[model samples]
Each structure stands twice: as C-alpha cells, then as structure tokens.
Target: MSEKKPSLLEGFKAFLMRGNVIDLAVAVVIGAAFTNIVNAVVKGVINPLVGAFGTKNLDSYSSCLKAPCEVGPDGEMQGIQIMWGSVLGATLQFLITAAVVYFLMVLPMARYLARREAQRKAKEGVQETLEVTELEVLKEIRDALVAQRAGGNAGPEGSPAPGDRG
Candidate 1:
C-alpha cells in the first residue's frame, strides 16, 4: 500500500514543533526581557564611567556641519548638526551587551560544554589515538610481514597469518 503524504498544514505544524524552533522562540523572548537588564547596566554603570570623560549623557555630544551650531531660545538649530552622541550611546550599549553575553553566558556555556564532553569521553573509555608517523606505520607493517615470512606465529593474535592456507 502507498503511504499517504502529509498535508502542507501538517508539515508546517511539524516544523513549528521542532525543538530548535521552540528554543529559538524562547531565546527571542528571553533576549527581549534581558535587554532591560543590559540597558540598565549600560546606563547606570557604563554611562557614568564614560561620562567622566566629558558629559553624563552621550546625547549632549554633537558636531556641526555648518557654521554657528548655536540653538535659539526655542531650541531651533541654525546649522546642520551631527548628533554623534546618539551614535556613541548606541555603540556603547551594543558593546556592553555583547561583552556581557560573551563573558557571562557564551564563554561559560562553551567551557561547560567542553568540560562535559571531555568527561563523557573519559567515562566512555575513549582513548585518543597516538600521533603515529608514516614511518612508524610502515615499520609496523614490515615487522608483521617479516614475522609472517619467518613463521614466527604472528597471526593477528588469533586468525592465521597472510601466507597461511586455511
């Protein structure tokens, strides 16, 4: 009997139910929530430290493309202004977030995974192969052949050697 094919809806449902998709969805939610914490750290800690260089808030830093960057009493600018403070703030926030994620989460998780895998391999008694040179392999093969020709009973520890008839 021919097997029935899954409908598009069923296929889509299966894809949505995959572990990675669910994990990605959860990660997106958690990342959105974690943004507040990162932002708080940047604003409360990093911003002050950076502000010691010039201003408390990066938004105050600007460059004027045209002459007379002065603003009127109504906050109307007289020339073109490059708000580099906003760029600095955004860059600082991104750097802080990346550093925190790398140091606190990514680094630790990678270390843990590496340690776990090593431990698992050790538990499974998986021995790492020695780095044998080509010459060493050739020597081993030569010794086995010599022992076989000499009939010195080197038959792979159990079976008959190469020249043996049955």
Candidate 2:
C-alpha cells in the first residue's frame, strides 16, 4: 500500500492550527495593544513628572559634541549633538514594559504551570498505585485458579474424575 503525503497548503494549515502557534499569535497581538497603553502612560504621567525637573519633551535635551553647534535658516544642525534625554526616555519605557510583562504575565504563568504539573504528578501517582493493586489482585486470582486445578484432578487427557461414570 502507498501512503499519501500532505500538500503544502495542508501542512501550513496544520501548522497554523497548532496550539502554540495560535497562542503566540494572540500574545503578539496583546503585546502590541499593551505597548500602546505603556506609551500613553509614559507620555501622560512619566513625561510630566520628568518635566518638573526639566523640559516636558525628552528630545529637546541634548549636549553639544563639537563646537559651533548652530542651526541653519532651514532648521538644520551644523555640528554633532548628543540627545541623551531621548535615550533615557526609551530606556525607561523598556524597563517599564519588561517589569510589567514579567510580574503580571510571566510570573503568574509560571506559577500556574507549576500547579498544573504538581496536579498531574499527583494523579499519575494514584494511577500507578491502582495499577499495582490491580496487578497484585490478578496474580492472586491466577494462583488460586492454579491451586484449585492442581487439588482437583480428572486424570490424564481424555479421562474423567474418579466419581464420574464414563
């Protein structure tokens, strides 16, 4: 008999239908949405807080690297200027995202998986005990049958018990 191979489309469909793939897609979508929320919080809350110390806009903070760091009439820079405030803002955003994802999503998921694993192990232990008990009962039954057969003998093959009339 010849076995049929799946088509490319069928293979792709099967891949997409897998649980991990669907879960990953959902996670990506949720992460994108969560990023928007994080960005809004940083802009609305963090920026204002930092504004108390400096400017509300992080990009406005910079340091001149070379001399004559002047802007042209068309609003172009003439020298190298390092915008460290923007880097600091980006770093803060990343830290906030990482902290929230770890504490809320990753930590809880790890705890839940650990609990599920413990429950599975407990169930397997009970099943193993039941299997052992069943095997022992079967052995006892087999031994009892053997004893009964040995104690009561008909004779050799094609023969009857002593009390039977043939």
Candidate 3:
C-alpha cells in the first residue's frame, strides 16, 4: 500500500516545533535588545571619550568629497560627503559585541562539547576492552575442556586411570 504524504501545514508545524528554530527566535530577540545596549554604550561612553579630540557626535564628522559640499538653512546637503566617523563608531560596536559573545558563549560551549565527546569515547573503549577480555576467557575455557576430553586416560570423578589399577 502507498503511504499518505503529510500535508503542507503539518510540515510547517513540524519545522516550527524543532528546538533549533525556537532557539533561533529567542536569540534574535535577545540580539535585538543587546544591540540597543551596545548603541547606548557607543553613544554615551565611547562618544565622549572620542569627543575629547573632536566633535562628540560621530554623524557630524564628515568630509566634502565633491569639494562643494554645503548645508543650506534648511539643513540640506548640496554635495557628496563621506561620513567616516559614523562608520568607525558602528565598527567599534560590532567588534565589542562579537568579542563578548565569542569569549563568553561560544568558547565555553565548544570546550564543554569536546570534553563530553572525550568522555564518551573513553567509555566506549572500556566496554570494548571488557568484551574482548570476556571472549578470550571463554576461548581459554573451551580449549581446556577439549584437551581434557581428548586425554580420556582417567575415569570421571577423580577416579584412577583404568590401566593404573593393579
């Protein structure tokens, strides 16, 4: 009999029920909240520190690439301006976030997984050795029984050999 195929809704539900998808959703939410904190730190602490040498607002720092850049009374730019300072600020935030996540989360998880794998392998090795030892003992017992039967010069139950009795 041909098996019935699952419907599209069933397949979608199964995908959503997986642990990885739920974990990813949670991570995305947390990451969004973390971005806000990183943005605040950049705007508050880092900006003031960098502001010591120049303007405090990173977005305000720019260069006239076209040499005719001008801001009108309505705060409209007339030429191309390269905003390198904003890019630097964004880069710093990303680096800080990445470093923290790697050191605090990724590295420890990796080490734990490696340790667990090693323990599993060691346990399997012990079980395999025990099996091999048991097999060797069984073979030894079988060989002894075969040799005793072949000799047959003595009777059963510790009695003297038939030819030894005078």
Candidate 4:
C-alpha cells in the first residue's frame, strides 16, 4: 500500500498553526500597531525637541538639487529634493521601537523565564537530595537487619544497633 501524501492546503495549514508562525504573525500585527504610537511620539515629542535647534516641521527640511524650485500658488514645490528630515524621523522611529520592544517585552520575558527555570532546578535539587537520603536510610536499615540476623538476635524487640539510633 502506498502512503498518502498530505495535500498542499493541509501543509500550509499546519505551517500556519505552528507555534512560531502564530507568534510571528501576532508580533507582526502588534509591531504594526506599535509603529503608529511610536510615530506619534517621534513626531510630537522628539521633533519638537529637535526643533529647538531648527524647525519643528522636518518634512520641509530638504535640499533641492535643481535651484529655483518651481512653487505653485498653494505653497507647493516641484524639484528634485533630498528629504533628509523624513529619513531622520524614520530612523528615530525605528530606534525607539527597537528599544521599547527590548525593554518592555524581550527583557522582561527573559527574566521571567530565567526565574522560572531557577525555581524548577531548585525543586529538582531538593528532590534529588531526598532520594539520596532515602536510599542511604534504606541501606542502613538493611545492614542493621542483617547484623541482627547474624548475631541470632533478630526478635521483634531486638537491641538497637549503633547505626539504628533515632
């Protein structure tokens, strides 16, 4: 009998359902939403602060390659312009987003996971110690019983051995 191959749709569904894929999708959606907030902060707070040096409107800060740039009646321009201000704004937005995600999400999650792992290891260490102690106790009891049998004093109320002291 030939083994049936999974359909393409089934494979795609499985890939989508995988934990990493789902997490990435969620992250993308969250990042997209976070981008808006970050943009607002950069535009509102940062640009104004930088405006102390120059102007608040960064988009207008550009160098026209062709001098005498044509201007319309409605305060519009037409010329080859290098918009470095917009680039600066975009760059700042990216840096802020990365920093926020690292501190707010990645750093906290890593710390929490580390703490959880430490607690689990501590519990396991305690359990291991208990197991070792139990084994040692059992061995002692067996040795005591053997000694009593050899001495022909294996009664219910036999004298306690040195190792058998409570």
Candidate of highest TM-score: 3
Worst 10 residues of 4 by lDDT: 153-162
Clash count (model 3, backbone only): 0
Better of 2 and 3 by lDDT: 2
- Listed in order, each prediction's TM-score against the native is 0.65, 0.65, 0.73, 0.72
Distance (Å) between predicted and true CA of 90, model 2? Answer: 0.7
The TM-score of predicted model 2 comes to 0.65
lDDT of 1 by residue, 1-166 (tens): 9999999999999999999999999999999999999889888998898899989898889999997899878989988889999899999899888998999999999999999999988866634333345567889999977877797544777776666777
Cα lDDT, model 3, residue 123: 100
Q: Where does model 1 exceed 4 Å of error?
A: 1-8, 72-76, 126-166
Q: Which residue pairs overlap in candidate 2's backbone?
A: none
TM-score of 4: 0.72
Please, what are the lDDT tens digits per residue for candidate 2 over residues 42-71? 899888899999999887889999866889
- Model 2, backbone clash pairs (residues 3+ apart or across chains), number: 0
Q: Identify the runs in model 2 with alpha carbons over 4 angstroms from their true place.
A: 1-5, 113-166
- Tens digit of lDDT per residue, candidate 3, span 48-147? 9889989898878888898678987889888899999888888888888898789989999999999999999999999999999999999999998778
lDDT of 3 at 71: 84
lDDT of 4: 0.86
Top model by lDDT, which number? 2
Between which residue pairs do clashes occur in model 3?
A: none
Candidate 3 segments exceeding 4 Å error:
1-21, 155-166
